[model samples]
Target: MKIRSRRFKHALASLSCAATLLLAPLASSIALAADPEKEELKLGFIKLTDMAPLAIAYEKGFFEDEGLYVSLEAQANWKVLLDRVITGELDGAHMLAGQPLGATIGFGTKADVVTAFSMDLNGNAITVSNAVWAEMKKHVPMANGKPVHPIKADALKPVIDQYKAKGKPFNLGMVFPVSTHNYELRYWLAAGGINPGYYAPAKGDITGTLSADALLSVTPPPQMPATMEAGTIHGYSVGEPWNQAAVFKGIGVPVVTDYEIWKNNPEKVLGVSKAWAEANPETHKRLVKALIRAAMWLDENDNANRAEAVEILARPEYVGADAKVIANSMTGTFEYEKGDKRAVPDFNVFFRHNATYPYYSDAIWYLTQMRRWGQIGEAKPDSWYFETAKKVYLPEIYQSAASELVAEGKAKAADFPAATEEGFRAPSSDFIDGLTYDGRQPNAYIEQFSIGLKADSKL
Candidate 1:
């Protein structure tokens, strides 16, 4: 889809959507300016391109429209961000999808963090250092002069074997213990028969490299390229603009994106403490309302505002990467090596495919990953997955925001999920391993994996 002038105007229409929504009947649009439990808010985020929704809501005046003044802060790391939100220092944050689930399940710092809005989908990639890529390139199939992509981890297995044969360990980095990056890296390596290791949190084993081919650990997102260049880790799985930063710096090549692993996979979300959400229900709903408008602006008319969005994200306070680096993935194309650019329009999906809506299947998938890698440490009934998803993912709040947007003519009913949606996506086999997953029957889905524990299997 081309970025056109008319669509740019459409993208900016959300500016007026807020003002128009204010004039709506008192019976309509649920936001009451007089009734917010709180107005001024502080939100936290790490410096990644997928944080655009929070940035957009603030910069575009969407928050002000809801009678809310928002202050967006960049946190040092995922743990700090989650801790701040949990401690009431920050009202909410851009969080990994697994953060809420991991918190609720007592995987890490146990707090009842919950998300009403899913921020974006598929903004991550697994990148290998130049030396590793040089060795792996020999095993990758080539088309013309470029290596065929959606590169399987099979290409890296030989390189790992060479490292092992030399009595050196091959290490990789993910952002956090329960991050989607860790799971995606594990999934890719396991699909190639390389054990990315496992966790046994029950036994106080969270190093995640108990029985491993490539030992995986945590490195903050901004530091990934530096860490790889310093020879600390061979590769990393992380969100943009870190992945694109590696390509631009000529230090590493992104082997495969998460999109290639699972098509339209859910990624980040806006998480707040469950206690905070319960105390300020109206404020939470209004915040989600502003974010939904921002998402719609982002994806309207095929991402027509993306260039403008890139410019905004490049500002010092937001993602703060070079605009060119951020645009590598933001503008509908992703560069693998220096010049091997290919169209991946959905690489940084903000709203398309109903990306903002929280789904039960999305939560269950993360829960399954935790169980598969032995983080959960025990088998549970399928009903537990469903109930956990309900507690963490607040689809009802999203519906309130969406309905308000519709009532005020700010969004069309057709543009949102059906009111009757049961909160599950149709079962999909869109994984790199070619296995289907049905959220309703998590045990059955777990059984389909060739590697990793089945429902009853333990570490």
Candidate 2:
């Protein structure tokens, strides 16, 4: 009887040990889950309407809800913003979509930057000085005594030619070399039979003016209108409210919005250093969640909150533009010629159409533009584009944040791309030029263009 009792006692002790082993890992995982590694963060942004995601996230308390106390600073310009992110002076920042791709590939600065959240879509436009617009208006087709919508670069072509006829340089301004504005301006010019020029980085010519019809240069976003007004640049492509500021100041006329350049194009993104992301995984994911929520709020009920957003963006500490100027684009209308306000509800998309998701295809599109110009300086296989895109765009982190939003009932699952989405959007031909682009076929897409470098054409 004594031996049997001891056997039972030994069996119970083994069962207890097994139970503790099973429960221990579960407890550890529960503890590790959702807790931020670093809660206090310093984020940077340029003063643009698209920087609204970070602004909304802060003013709306999305960061604090995740136990993060974030301090937002307005960087002087895109270069300064990118530099701060690279040097760890900022936890993350509102970045041009191409900024991360440009940095990773050694275009200007070499850094391992990754983005999971795209800040907004279709916020940029091409605006010409009043004097330039007067010449352009003569060539533009009109309707009902008003200039027609989507005034293309074809209209500006005659103006550029007139400048060339008089031995004058036709200068255009873009935000950055690797910026979407740069690519869009070039695309518009090339489509209209104008040579916007090329960058032969390998040949030590960053001027991008080899056999060019229009000279393109970088002007800071805020200074763009003033620079154009000063006659330093005849026209400029930049994000709002500067374009609207031109009309308000009676200094310029916005010729085209980026929506007409590339319909539903991906614009700005929230970028972080790869090292910072790895070291603080939880914090990074939570920050994306906050940004996602902010995006959703911006687009909720088809921009019901935009008036509030415009107010927030107009503050001196933020965009610092007049509320009316900011509202010109933010509130579903854009002023082209001072009084030519038209409805463009998608003018500033924050969340709808999966704008927040960082797709590898978007990265590839930017890279193809870099190569098409002279920034890439060489021809690479399509696989190289794919691999580079995956390395730079952290879609896995986007999924994690999106999944949390869906699970908590904060957002619907249908609002995100399918969990099985391959990070490439369907091949689209929605640009003003009507050129179809398949991200999977970068080389073929390059061959489609009449101007710019081709697959065999190297700078």
Candidate 3:
């Protein structure tokens, strides 16, 4: 009644083999779903430590893991970098937080630039030439033989007034018109009752000093020290190595960092043209994921990796300055006067304190500053500010990339903004003057400050 044992065993083995073949494609489909659309990419950056994320991402193979090949190149300046991205000569770039907004609004160059990734936070300082610092030191308050921290612009205002009364222009340098340095410098000067001038687009004057007390102008970041040394500018606001270079050369003293002006302020961003982003959405998301990983690496272990990062930044193509000079600020310490080094752990934050998130509040703050200085030229309704911020900051893109990382088990949910995030941060009153800023009520916030042109005010 029984069949042959060999034939029965053969049939059972054949069925099991078929089942294994059927399930193989299911697993393969899961793997293939995670691969990036485009594998090769080109990104641009300036010679600054904040660009460490791009370097780290490329060196650490984070991009490779995402099936992306990336090349990091240093641009001559912010303008050239932004221009390349706009013209599609580069895929994206390490950008000034304002670059994307400024470009989108037709400030300097007209393009639809967008950013989902903020590169870092609080990596800039305002440095004054030694001669200027010596003159202002008399007005600064001394505590325990050291000038008080967050040295107010009040001290510098008197020095500038002296220059003005003597018929000399009080010139200062910022890297760009819409740069954080320009806004921060203007904010500090305005807080101290110094009019930093205005930008009159209607009058064909973007010089930003239409009846001003201090005439502000643009100087490339690396050239800040030389510009000041040549007497072309008396002071400057720029990202590090340049500021620290001045101190090492016995040329200047850094009065304050952007952190003191606006705590944990957003600095640079990963900028790309809106057209490029749309055409290569998958590639853009993969790029963001890799950058987020690099940012976490930069800030991981409380910046234990900064010394190594400074070394990488010191190479010729990168910052190209002495490691010691870059380390002065990169390693959680900053020197004020010669030999006055102090701990400022957040001076160069890359990822912590929500540094990677491109908050709508941050964009609105810059917009308010523009309006304050007559850059906007007229009263904009609160809706216009919010809409403009939304146009430039692509939170939706950030979410897509973060979700992909989570799905791949490469990142955790806690590492990113919550699903319930409203894009805007809570109202903050952490300014140097203790004034409150609410992104939703920008005009009201602008009116709270003692200085700056308000709604409907022109130069």
TM-score of each: 0.93, 0.93, 0.93
Residue pairs with clashing backbones, model 2 = 198-208
List the lowest-lDDT window of 10 residues for candidate 3: 1-10
Supply the global lDDT for candidate 1: 0.91
Query: Comparing candidate 1 with candidate 2, which one achieves the higher lDDT?
Result: 1
Off by over 4 Å in 3: 1-31
- Model 1 alpha-carbon drift over 4 Å, by segment: 1-34
Error of 1 at 183 (Å): 0.9
Models, CA RMSD each: 5.7, 10.4, 9.6
Ranking by lDDT: 1, 2, 3
Q: What are the Cα lDDT values of the candidates?
A: 0.91, 0.89, 0.87
Clashing pairs in 1: none
Tens digits of lDDT, candidate 1, 153-229? 99999999999999999989999988999999999999998988888888888898888888898999999999999
| Residue range 1-459, candidate 2, lDDT tens digits | 002223444565679978888889787566445679997688898889999988888888788767677878898889999999999999999999999999999888999999988888899999999898898899888999999877888888888888899999999999988889999899888888999888887888888788899999999999988898889999899999999999999999999999988999999999999999999999999999999999999999879999999999999888999999999999999889878889999999998888998988899999999988878998999999999999999889999999988988988899999999899999999988888999999889998988888876775
